[model samples]
Each structure stands twice: as C-alpha cells, then as structure tokens.
Target: MADEKPDFEVPVGLFEDFEDLKAQVARLTAQLQTLTEGAGEEADEASADDVTAGAEEADRGDAPEDEWQYPPFILLLDPPQYDDELRALTEWVEGVLVPGYLAEPSSDARWCHLWFEHPVAVARLHALWLAWQELTDPASCGYTGPSVWHRDHLDPSMRELRGSSGPFAGCTKGEHQIDHRIPGLVPSAWRQNDA
Candidate 1:
C-alpha cells in the first residue's frame, strides 16, 4: 500500500515531429529529377547518331592525340624523384623486377594488367619492390610478396584483346573473371632466401 495509488500524467510533446520536413525533401527531390530529365530530353534524342559516330571514331583509335595525355593520376608512371626510398624502389621495379617477371610466359598477362592500373605505375613498381623485399625480408617475403598484377593481363585483357578486332570482339557472352593479380601463387616465393 505504499504510494501505489496515483502517478503523474505523461508528457504529450516529447518527440520531435519531422513529417513536414520529410515531405518537403521528398517533393524537392522529385522536382529536381523531373527538371533534370526535362532538360536532357532534347539532348538525349539528338545525340543518338552523334554518339554512334563518336564511338566509331574511337574504334578507329583516332579520338585525339590529346586524349592520350592521361589525367594527373596517370603521371605517376614514374615515381617521385625526391624520395630516395621510393625512387630506388621504382627504378628497381622498372629495371629489374618487371623484366624478370615478364620473362615468365604464365605471368606476363597478370603483370601487364597490374602496370596499367597503377595511377602512376606504382602497382607494378610496388610488385617488384615486394618481390625484392621477399628476397630480403625474412618473415613473409615469399609468403606474400606484393601480389600486384598488370591490369591488361587478366580476363579484361582477354576482353580487350578479343574485343578490338577479333572473333570475340562483339561476343560479350562468356564467363570472365577479373584476374587482378596472380591467383593461387604459393607463399614460398615471397620468403627471404635464407629464411
């Protein structure tokens, strides 16, 4: 019988109601999409022929000389000249590692694609460094020596290689996997020689 009789009334306005705000946002988004779609309607209809012609031009590899000049990311092909460690590493990659790796027929495609993906060719260079480090580092060199592969070496390579001017060029029907790097390589190659 201790104070079990009466309790205070619960507050009515505890939670913030955002239904009006949410409705406004939904209406605005719909309006924006409609506006943008309307704006592009004419361009979309008129560009069909132009788009096809442009694609044909691109197919001929006559897009434009300037087009070959890649974005800032592509300039990383060569490592920065300032950092000694990176510079040495890059040089080693270009001069030593890639050449050795490419000598193997099986890995040629894998490494090539890896080189293409490097905004600055860092992947291939790093792969080489990792290979070298494998020779030096005692712990996990052979086990996980940088597993970078060239971009053009994988199934994408197969697509491009087949796509440009071959029987499979337009045949987009097939099971293809993007082989980013050498898959299923044994860890022993990455280990230090002595280790």
Candidate 2:
C-alpha cells in the first residue's frame, strides 16, 4: 500500500483557466501598486509645464471627457458610469456590509432586497461607502480610521437606512415591497405658473 501511488485526475482546461486567472491577478496587483505609489508623488512632482500640457491636451479633446475621477458621486454619474458604480456598490453592500453588520432583519431594523431601486437609499449608501473608503484608509485617516468610520459614518447611516420609518419602511426581512413609493412633494407656485 505504501508503494502504491494515489491516482487523481485534473482537467486540462481547469489548469489553463487557473493559470490565466493568476496572470490577470498579478497584472492587476502590479497596476494597483503602481497607481497607489504614484498618487501623491505625481501630484507633488508635477511641474507647471506638465499641468499646462495636460490642460492643453484636455482642451484639444485628446483626453477622454468621460475619464473617471476619484470619489465620484453616484447620482451625478452618466448612465454607463452609474451602472459600473452601482455594480461596485452592490458588491460592497452584499459582500461586506450585509454579511458583517446587517445580517439580522426585524420589524425595527428593516432592509430592502431591492435597495438600489430607491434613489435616496442608493445616494445614502454611496455616501456611506465613500466615507468608509476614506475613513478606513490608514494613510488617509490614521490609526483611529476604523473607529471613526464606525462612530461617525457607519452608525448614523445604518440607523437611517434600517430605521422603521426609513426608505425600507415598506420592505421587510423576508419580502421586498415592489410598489413602494416616495411621497410626492407639493408643487411650487412658480412651477405651477408655468403650467
């Protein structure tokens, strides 16, 4: 028995796919490291000529107008950009926020499965995500970053989002309220005059 070798079979395509995924991960990791290292250095080291040249290129439309800027607000983004951002937000919400903090659901602490459908909820969650990113970054927010995030950003946002009277008021732990509606505001006299 000791002399006999155990027989196991692995699929050829699975090995190739695994190798491809590893290579992609390596490339992405290198790119992320480069960007992280350059972020502050590039800003500080840029000469006036570099700035002027960049501005000139932008004016000439050589730079793409839709080039992403950091810390983008979800509501202000174009449809394509918004869709990309929403995907990322959904990932964070489902992966981190829900699993870590909001797993339990109750009458007092409600959560909507279709949270992204609610504009106000989306905006608030986006803001909370932005704050979480900044506050949890050690270089940006220091040693107390996580603590600050929980105390200042997380707690309030969660309370508001999960409150009984909040945006998820119509939703419940077990069900999503498809027909949930925001109350209509009274029309302004000036706007009514235009009609």
The 0-to-1 C-alpha lDDT of every candidate, in the order given, reads 0.43, 0.80
Candidate 2 local lDDT, 17-113, one digit each (tens): 5655665677578779867876858576899998899999879857545554467789877789999999999999989999899957788888888
Q: lDDT by residue for model 1 over 14-127, one digit each (tens)? A: 211243345456757877987798697776576778888888997985755534332222223334532554556667756765565444323222233233333224533444
TM-score of 1: 0.22
Where's the lowest-lDDT run of ten residues in candidate 2?
Answer: 186-195
The true-versus-predicted C-alpha distance at residue 191 of model 2, in Å, is: 16
Model 2 CA lDDT for position 115: 94
Clash count for candidate 1 is 19
Error of 2 at 177 (Å): 2.5
